[model samples]
Target: MTTTASVQVYTTNYCPYCTRAKQLLTKRGIAFEEIDVSNDDEKRAWLVKTTGQRTVPQIFIQGSPIGGSDELHQLDRSGELAKRLAAA
Candidate 1:
């Protein structure tokens, strides 16, 4: 149950939530792929279409959407994030 799920985060450069999310993931020793959509209209549009969310800090864990910073923090606090991260 230690499968390293690939984490992908869509964020902007100046988003505080994005910063916090990255920090939390780093603290947990998780490596993630960060896509900065600050000026990329196409990617942002794709995110909106794909997630129905037009905000920075959109995250996907092992191809599963895990939402933004608040949700991620909540999951971490509830120990769900750890469980998800450890899932095979």
Candidate 2:
């Protein structure tokens, strides 16, 4: 199911998990806004403060922070991802 929800992915260069996360979203036909924080320390700090995660590939679906790559995959496998996306 293609998602109409706003999806934002915070990523950095040289992160394999970030690549995988983007691939999964593409495979699922989900369009997302990719925010590259490779050289943006300010944005990275903001992400850490917002999501409590210091890693790359932090994902937010419909303004709610879901988590990183592993969490994204788990949501997909459990069929929760579609439901989250479909919510108003």
Candidate 3:
């Protein structure tokens, strides 16, 4: 990761938004830990329980939920994602 923020993204292999999210983060030079929960029921369950969202590509920055693909795009568009990613 370029920044000190610990970014974790929960994703499924077949999710297009997951790919987009990764691409956006990579384009911003942000590195993240991607958890592939495609076949892992336990991890998926855990993600849902923690995030309250049963969708793929649940993203976290420094353990703070930043929401999914559209939210990420919105953050990037509003220049907040860069600020957050650049944060410690």
Write the candidate numbers in order of decreasing lDDT.
Answer: 2, 1, 3
Show pairs that collide, candidate 1: none
Which has the better TM-score: candidate 1, or candidate 3?
Answer: 1
The deviation in Å at residue 67 for candidate 1 is 0.5
Residue 67 miss distance in model 3 (angstroms): 0.8
Candidate 2 residue pairs that clash: none
Over 10-66, each residue of candidate 3 has an lDDT whose tens digit, in order, gives: 998899999999999888778889999999999988888898999989999999888
What does candidate 1's lDDT look like per residue over 1-88, in tens digits?
Answer: 2336899999999999999999999888888899999999999999989889999899999988889999999999999998888883
Model 3, residue 56: C-alpha shift (Å): 0.7
Go through the candidates in order and give the clash count of each.
Answer: 0, 0, 0
lDDT tens per residue, model 2, 1-88: 6877899999988999999999999999999999999999999999999999999899999788999999999999999998888883
**lDDT score at residue 26, model 1, on the 0-100 scale:** 86
| Ranking 2 against 3 by lDDT, winner | 2
Residue 33's lDDT within candidate 3 is 95
- Which stretch of 10 consecutive residues in model 3 shows the poorest summed lDDT? 1-10
Report the C-alpha displacement of residue 84, candidate 1, in angstroms. 0.9
User: TM-scores, in order shown?
Assistant: 0.92, 0.96, 0.91
Best-matching candidate per TM-score: 2
Off by over 4 Å in 2: none
Model 1 weakest 10-residue run by lDDT: 1-10
